[model samples]
Target: MKLSSPENQAETAVTSSLQAFLETDIAPKANRLDTDTIALQRALSQLNQFQFLGLRVPKVYGGLEASLLTFRQVQALIPRYSGAFAFLQTQHQSAASLLANSENQVLKERYLPAMAKGETLMGVGFSQLRRTHNPPLTAIPVEGGYQLAGKVPWITGYGYFQYFIIGATLPDGKALYGVVPLIPTPQPEGGNLEFSSPMQLSVMNATNTVAATVENWFLSEEEVLFIKPANAIHDSDKKNVLHHGFYALGCARAGLDILENNAGKKELPFLEESHQTLAQKHQSLSEAMFAALPPTETSFQYRLSLRVKAIHLAQRCAHAAVISSSGAANAQSHPAQRVYREALLFSVSGQTKAVMEASLNTIADYV
Candidate 1:
């Protein structure tokens, strides 16, 4: 798909095609995907048909094997069309990437090819491993493998994904990652896995976020994805901290799209002028974040500062979109309201203690 090149702003065939597909199919019905499960599932299936489900999977696994820049571009591009679509599909893509990197050849071969082609869709629920409090979920060593017990606080895409990779803490503070069914599993080997109803949320509700109460859920060795030492996720979060900002970057674009559209519809000179100013700020932030990506010596603190800036910029752009949309933005179906809520998600998604402090500090104008 001509996915990668040296430049960040350079348009690739993949991104161009994705943009065309999104604008034609997804953008027009962004609001519907938030509330309509059938429409959202159809949109996801179309994405699979186009092979975008495999962007991060290795070529050996029937994936595009695109560079990080290419994947990040897709990350930014999708949310502009539909935040719900972006939010839902990313869970599958994350699972694919993890499988691609797994040492379990059997597990990788069993899942990666199908995952890449969306023949066997998957979701991920490892965020609970990042919580500072006692692990909401725990893993106990057993003869064949480990038994998972406790609650998986968040696992999006219930019906859309048949399976998901779960993370639970072990006694030594390490974590066990395993692929398990998304459905309520029977009490095989004297264990049970049950999920709650779809979580009611302000945004991306159609994605069917759910929680699981896993009681001694037997996980065979073949089902294990991988295991990591203590503090691995935290260290990884610090390294890839800027990745989620790509969503905010695209959301800023969504807000600007609405602001510019309203500027023309209302023919308000002040709105147009405000759009121009915000657009420039968005551009500067986008470039700085992109340049700080890979092959650069950008320090952790600097990248974090860029992330904080992107979060704040997204909120500002969303506010502007809401202001331009005027009183009508209060409607649930309003695009401005959708983009505003998306901005809220990006502000806190993948948040760590350090990111939280920085984001809150920026919120307080403590910059």
Candidate 2:
């Protein structure tokens, strides 16, 4: 939990590095990134060249090991240029963060160093465990390690990641996290990893999100990342409740950028005023969200409220951009249109029941 440096200085360094990369490389190609697999792949690689992929890994593991605020700053800045890259990179960063906390030295050594440099890439598939129902994925103890069987309803980065960390419930009411192949691979015991065609999502479909059936797949000890109590995600969610809001904040900025540009082009006084009003609101929300990051500083309920506010602002800002742009914004590739769609995705990116409720209430207030 130690920060890398003073907050302001760290923020500047991270923001400048990411902004330079995004403006120079991603902005010109933003419109095509939504469905261009090659463009997404190249973007992912180029991010690695700048060591962005390793932002969360420990410094000892050769990562930039940025402060949490700095890391979240990157999250907010990225979607301003390309939502697909923002969405895709977050998956890998999540995997790297999980691995960095592992008690399994062997697994840490195998992945952390390479992950820090983007020499290795991975994804995560465990959100299904959030549902309180018959487990969609389960693991049973075996001679060598554990046997995992069932379905992973959502696994992104199919063609982009070589391996991914899958989470499944254990009979003892614990959660088992282990590395599994991202590609299709048959097991010896009439078992296999089979994936459906990449889903055509409303946004970031280029990340190749797909469901998988893991039938009798054996997860060896060497590949095991860690095991935690069943409530781990719920607890983690409480602690990191504000984490995903930064993406929405970034998306809001994207909308404002479009709105400001259009205002200048059209010389509309009202549009300019609208941009300033919305920009100030976004700034206020941004500051409040950052100030509330310390777990002890705010109640979970308040943090949840801030998170929902961020979600609503993103939607509102994007909606404003759409309204200001007139007919041309209807183009399938319009930046405003894309940012609007991204707003929808970020609204529920890491939604829990409380988050879901809070977000709906915010929308209802607008209605």
Q: When superposed on Cα atoms, how far off is each prediction in RMSD?
A: 2.5, 2.4
C-alpha local distance difference test of each model: 0.90, 0.89
Compose the digit string of candidate 1's lDDT tens values, residues 67-125: 88788888888988888999999999899888888899999999889888889999999
Sequence-dependent TM-score of model 1: 0.96
Off by over 4 Å in 2: 1-14
Candidate 2 achieves a global lDDT of 0.89
Q: Candidate 1: which pairs clash? A: none
Q: Can you give the TM-score per candidate against the true fold?
A: 0.96, 0.96
Can you give the lDDT of residue 168 in candidate 2? Answer: 93
Clashing pairs in 2: none
Least accurate stretch of 10 residues (summed lDDT) in model 1?
3-12
